[model samples]
Target: MLTKRIVPCLDVNDGRVVKGIQFVELRDAGDPVELAKVYDEQGADELVFLDISASHEGRKTMVEVVQHVAAELAIPFTVGGGINSVEDMKAILRAGADKVSLNTAAVLRPELVREGADYFGSQCIVVAIDAKYDEETNGWKVYTHGGRKLKDLDAVEWAKEVEALGAGEILLTSMDSDGEKKGFNLALTKAVSEAVTIPVIASGGAGNAVHFKDVFTEGKADAALAASIFHYKETSVEEVKSYLRKEEVHVR
Candidate 1:
């Protein structure tokens, strides 16, 4: 079986790492570069840096911040937020991200996905989907602009669409569950994972080690990403990996 990846996400704003519940009420986490080094040292499988406010502010990701964070890690890094074109992707990649995740930009112009995959390889392209459950839709709806805008797109269908458009992976974050820390939204994770063949990195609502196991086993996620837990020293990456190993979930 493929080893499930445990990723630490740095939700950065103005070059500082921050975390918030349901995508609001942001709190200071730490310096992005410092947090990146700590997670890398703790054996994180990968690191994701998101300039959470960039898209909403109409700008590109902080390349300087990305470069600093990238310098601290030996593991793969993914960057997202405010990437609007192939040139933007190039800049982020040049700054040292192993992959560039497109959220708002991709939704606005989905052909950008193919454009990026064609310029880089599919492996370098990840589409991030922020989803919130909608009883009116009878499923989850896609959110954009740092989870401030809701789109008509259905979360599961968007996953398949992006996969077909040549995105290498999906970063699925549940806005409803984001930062709640009770547990991941397993049902939503499972739905998106099963809908697409590409790897899915389930995000939001990761509370503890057992939450990781449940997401891997029942949610069928290829990897899981969390922020506040690791950011605040609530749990270390090594501890989570140890717990996963005990539960027979493969980890790297």
Candidate 2:
């Protein structure tokens, strides 16, 4: 059985980790390098460092910050935000990112995904879709630039498309559930997981251990990611995994 992964995200803005509701009203969380070390010591399966504002600010990812965070951790690290081209991917990888997650960049130039996959292999290409429920469409719509821009792309279709383009995984974050601590968006996660063959990491709305269980068992996500809950010392990764183990969910 493949063990489910528990990942903690560091949403960095202006060099500090921040958390917000529905991708707005940001609040400070902690230092990315410190948080990365904490999560690594806590046995987190992977650490995701997202420079949440870089894409919106029209800047490149913080290579120095990536190097700092990566140097502190002994686990896999994924760096994202403002990754626009093959050169950007190489830079992040060279700076010590185990994987590169593409959001707005991939949406604007989808060829980046194919090119990244060809150059770095599928395992290094991660397509992260930030989505929110659309009232008009009555389904999740993909958003970019930290959920500030609404695109006409369908979440499910995008999931399939990225996988077809050689993306090794999909990081699906629910704008509605983000920073709410209610729970994961199970329906949205299930839909995306079913739409793609590669692993899906469910992001947003994880308040408790049960939320992790729900996402892995009910949402069918291969991994579950949260920020504030773990950052604020609300829940520990060990506790989450212990509960999942009792629920017969495979977790590392």
Top candidate (TM-score): 1
| Model 1 alpha-carbon drift over 4 Å, by segment | 19-29, 53-61
Every candidate's lDDT:
0.88, 0.86
- What digit string (tens of lDDT, one per residue) describes model 2 on residues 1-252? 789999988877766676642222123235677667667777899988887664534234377778887787778989888788899899889888999999999999898999999999999999999999988978899998879999999999999999999999999999999878889999999999998899999999999999999999889999988887876678888888888889999877
Cα RMSD of all models vs. native, in order, equals 4.0, 4.2
lDDT of 1 by residue, 199-222 (tens): 999999999999999999999999
TM-score, every prediction = 0.91, 0.89
lDDT, model 1, position 10? 79
lDDT of 2: 0.86
